[model samples]
Every structure is written in structure tokens, then in C-alpha cells.
Target: MSQLDTPRLPENASDLRSLYRAAEARAARLRVLVEAGQVLAGATPETLDAAVCEVARAAAHLAGYESGRVVEDRPGEAGDDNGLIFPLTSPGSDVTSPGALVLEGRRSAPSAEDREAVAVVCQLIGASLSARAREARLARLLGELLRGQEIERSRIAHELHDGVAQNAAALMRRLELASDGDPADLAKARDQARALVRELRRVIAGMRPPVLDDLGLVPALQHLAAEARASGMAIALEIAPDPGHRPPPAIETALFRIAQEALNNARAHAGPDVHVTLRLAYGAGRWRLSVRDDGCGFDPDAGRAAHDAGGLGLAYMRERIELLDGCLTITSAPGAGCSLLAEVPAA
Candidate 1:
């Protein structure tokens, strides 16, 4: 065979051993990357330190170093100079002082290949840490936004209940006392004032339901279903067996709001004689709330696009769920019905 066409093989035992070692190193590096991915996937503020430490240890193992550590480079603090240091830098940001990954007690100076592998691992770690930080910051902002919305709703509800509602009641009483006026005119005025009072009370309840705070989620949902029934919409509320357990106030508020929005959407879109179903279930370290209707449905993609373009009801529901680290899903088809399902961690 021509030399150019011949396949090459290791010529000696030493060469074979060298090839085997190189293969092993590559395998080790792959394993390290896989482990790092798992750590990053499950990362949270509570487990971040342990995750970083695990990544450092894996990098050190892959690079044939005795030990490695991740160090935050604080102001006025000295960093280790004896070992290889890889700075963790984020893109487009000068605000964060980069941390360092230090590898110590290497048997010999790292080869060019080894240094390259370590660099890749360091970059992975840095990106993961930066992503975790950004997620935490976004979560905080969402929490504040939800809290502000709740506060504003409470304020408006209080004003309507105490101001507008009270005035309407007083006007109704005045109409009742005017016996000298034309009987038909007085009756019509009194009815109009009473209707205004009922409408105002409904608005206040919708803005911020008192049952939600007083009796918790199940009772609040039941009350909502009763209201829907009164409005000529049939709403069925099904709660799991363990309805007594309550989540944190923020979580409860978020779930309630999401469910409320979903029901409102159904009431507005679903035609008469439609049966709406609301289900709440808790299990397996998570809780889920679902609202489903049998009325004509729209295209889910179109609905989602509309929501993205500032359809406040669905958008608000999604934001509230996401703020609590929950998931919201909408399902629909042209002739079928629409369903909204929200899930959050029970803990």
C-alpha cells in the first residue's frame, strides 16, 4: 500500500500508553462537563456554594491538580499568587468584580491542552454563576412588582367600599324617605341607587376579595364560584382532600389571582350555557390549579402572541405565576375549549 494511503497505528508500547492516557483525559473532561451541567441545572441561592465547590473539584480532578477552590475577589483582599488563577468575568458588565478559580499543588506545570480544558471549565462556571445571579435579581424584581400591584388593588378596593359604596347606600336611603315625591319616580330612583350600590360592591370584591384573606384559598374559590353562578355562568370548583394546608401569603395571592383571571377570561369569552371547571390539587411537592371551559376556543399561539403584545389579563396571570417560580400553560384549539394550568412548588 502507498504510504499516504496506509492507516497509522502506535508503533511501540510507549506510544500506545500515551494514546491511552490522552483518551482517558478526554473522557475525564467530558465527565466533568456533564457533572457541571447537572450542578448548574439544579442551582439555587441556597445550593450555589455547594454547586460551585463541586465544579471546582471536578476541574481540579480533570487537570491533575491536588485541590481547587472558587474565591470571591473582594476589595482590599489579597488573592493566591502561587497557583493557576482563572478570573470569572461576565460579558458587558464592569460592575461585578470578577471572582477567581485557583488550582494548587499540581504535580507539574499544566500542559497547553490541560490549561485549555481548565479555561473552558472556568468559563462554564462563570457563565453559570452569572446566570444564577441574574435569575435571583429578576425574581426579586417580580416579587416587588406583584407586591406593589396587590397594594394598589387593596387601596382602590378600600376607597370604593368606604367612599362610593357608602354614598350610594345613603342616596338609596334618601330616596326611600322621600314619600312626598311621585311614587313611580321615588321607586325608580331608589332602585337605581340600590343597583349602583350592588355594582360598586361587586367592583370592590373583584379588586380585592375579603374572603381570600379571611378564609384562605378554597373558601375564596368557592365564593368566586358562587358569584359566577349568580351571573348565570355555571362554575364548578373541585379542591383536593388536603385543602386545609395553606401556602405563604404571596403564593396564595398569586394562585388566587391566576385562577381569578382565568375564570374571568372564561366568563367573558365563553357563551351562555357553558360549564366552567376549576380544579386545585396538591401533591408530590407541588400544587396545581387549572381552569377549563367547554366553550369555543381560540388559537393558543394567537392568544399567546396577543398576551405578549400587552393583553393584560393573561400576561398578568403569567407574571404572577412566574414571580413565585411557578409555571403557567394555556391550551386551546379553534372549536375545542380553553384551559389554563398553573403549577408551583408546594414548599
Candidate 2:
């Protein structure tokens, strides 16, 4: 038969609808196979081709091939393998006949239509696979970066709490021991010592708020408000009683960082006299943090576009919230204001 006469493959609307059914069935089977292969891949953590094989078998089934198998081109199979094979069943028969329906283009002849279809399918599948791979890689990289940042912060916090703080206390004791001096000088020395202690505390708080570890999220948030007030920032923080509930550490951290970043953005870019508000509410077995600022707001979409060129603060905040299976919404308009809402399930 000619190339256009290659059995037509049922072109009627009813037949095409059935193709959807077939496609759904094929997708279900492929999902099962791929999921199973993923379990195996997780267990062994070394065999990628096997997982690809499992997925290919499903593709073959959907394409009406009788049987399919993945084969390697290498003699000893030391590297990646060749194309897939899907044997065809003879016409007017459900049973797969031997040595039929060959789709091996790299090693054998494949029809032009089949080749085009396969190329499109592979292109789509490849795009999906590449996206997934990139997500995994980015996750790993971000995890490493966060871990390193945490370590560095912890080190800096320790130095401030131990070395710098201790030296400030010693200076205070020495000031007390000094012979009589000008009252103004003594007053200035006392104020300078107190300022030094306050600066150290602020640094430690930034590294990791002590209340977060000791008191819980509420007190931690209160500390944030207190520090903001200390810095002359107009911050209004309101927290409903926890209702005797807590969130996972990761969720709490995510929310805290969201708040911190939002506040920082407001302070840095929103200009002075900016109004900041934070609210925490509980419902539907979840807790949400909402931050609003009446600053010189810009478009959220524009901010995202700007972020694509290496400005990662907002993106990082969104990533953290999403990693905890949460949703982040950013609403803003030029000269209107900015509002960020993040929700995470409570523990």
C-alpha cells in the first residue's frame, strides 16, 4: 500500500473519540508502570534506562503496537542504548505476530507518518522530562545554598553572642571601675555600651530569632514587630491566639521568611512612612500569613520579569512557601500597594 494508504487508522469522529479512550487507558497503564519504575529507581537509585523502558512500553501500548522492548546498541551495554522496538500484530488479528510492526528508525526503516508522530510525541515528552530534571537540579542547588547560609548565620550568631557580647560586658565592668570622670563622658560611655549590646542582639535576632526556637512562632513574630519598631519602621503585627495549634518547623520558617522578606522589601523600596501590617489566621486546618504594605507599589508581574534576570529574593520566598505544599499570592499595582498572602497547613 502507498504511504497515505497505510490503513488510515480509523479517522471518523466516533473512532477519534475512541482514540481518547484508548489514550486514557494507555496513560493509566503508563502511569502505573512509570510509578512502579520510580519506586524501583528510588530503591536502586542507579538505573535510568530501566525507568525509561517502563515508560516506553506504555507509549507502545498506546500506539496500538503488539509488543515492545528496549534494546541496547552497545556490545557489552556499558553506555546508553538505541531506539525502542514495537512489534505489530497482523491485520484482522489481536494476537501479535512475530517479527512485525518494527519502529526502529535508528536501526531500521520507519514510516514517515510514524516518524513525524513519534518526533512530536518525543519532543513533548522530552520537554516534560527536561523540565522535571531542571526542577530536581534546582531543588538540590537551593537546598545546598540554604544549608550553607544557615551554617554561616549560625556561626555569625555564635560570634556575636559569645565574643562581641562578652567584650561589651567586660567594658561595662571596666567603666564602673574607672576613677571619677566627667559626668558627660561617663554617660556617653554607658550609652555606647548599651548601643553595642543592642546591636549585637539585633544581629543575633536576624541570624535566628531566639523566640522561634524557645517560645514559638507567636513570640517570634512579636520579636519581629519589636525590632521593626526599634528601627523606627511603622509595623503593625497582629496574631490571633494559636488556638492551641502549631505548624511544622518548615512551614513556620517559610512563613517567617516570607514576612521578613516582605518587610525588608517595604523598608528598602517602599520609602519612609510606609505602613506595614501582618496578620495570622487559622481555618480549614491551615494557617495563613498575610502581609500588606501601603508603599509605592509596583506591578507584581513586572517584578517577576525583573526577577528572571537574577533577582531571586521574591522567587526564593515563593519557592520556600511552595516547598511546604503551600500557595503564595502576590497582589500589587503601581501606586496602589502590595499584598502577599501565603497559606500552609498546620501541624
Measured against the true structure, the TM-scores of the candidates, in listed sequence, are 0.52, 0.54
lDDT per residue for candidate 2 within 280-337, as digits (tens), equals 8778988889999898887777666442232236767776776677889988888878
lDDT by residue for model 1 (1-347), tens: 89999988999999999999999878877788878878867888788779889889878767767788888873221334445677765565423534878877775566677777777777777777787776766675566567557756776778787777777776766676776687776877767677677767777687778888987888888888898899898888899766568877887888887777677667667666788999998888888999999988778767654432322356557667776788899888876988889999876
Candidate 1 residue spans exceeding 4 A from truth: 1-200, 307-311
Total clashing residue pairs per candidate? 0, 1
Report the alpha-carbon TM-score of model 1 versus the true structure: 0.52
Q: Highest lDDT among the candidates is held by which one?
A: 1
User: What overall lDDT, based on C-alpha atoms, would model 2 receive against the true structure?
Assistant: 0.63
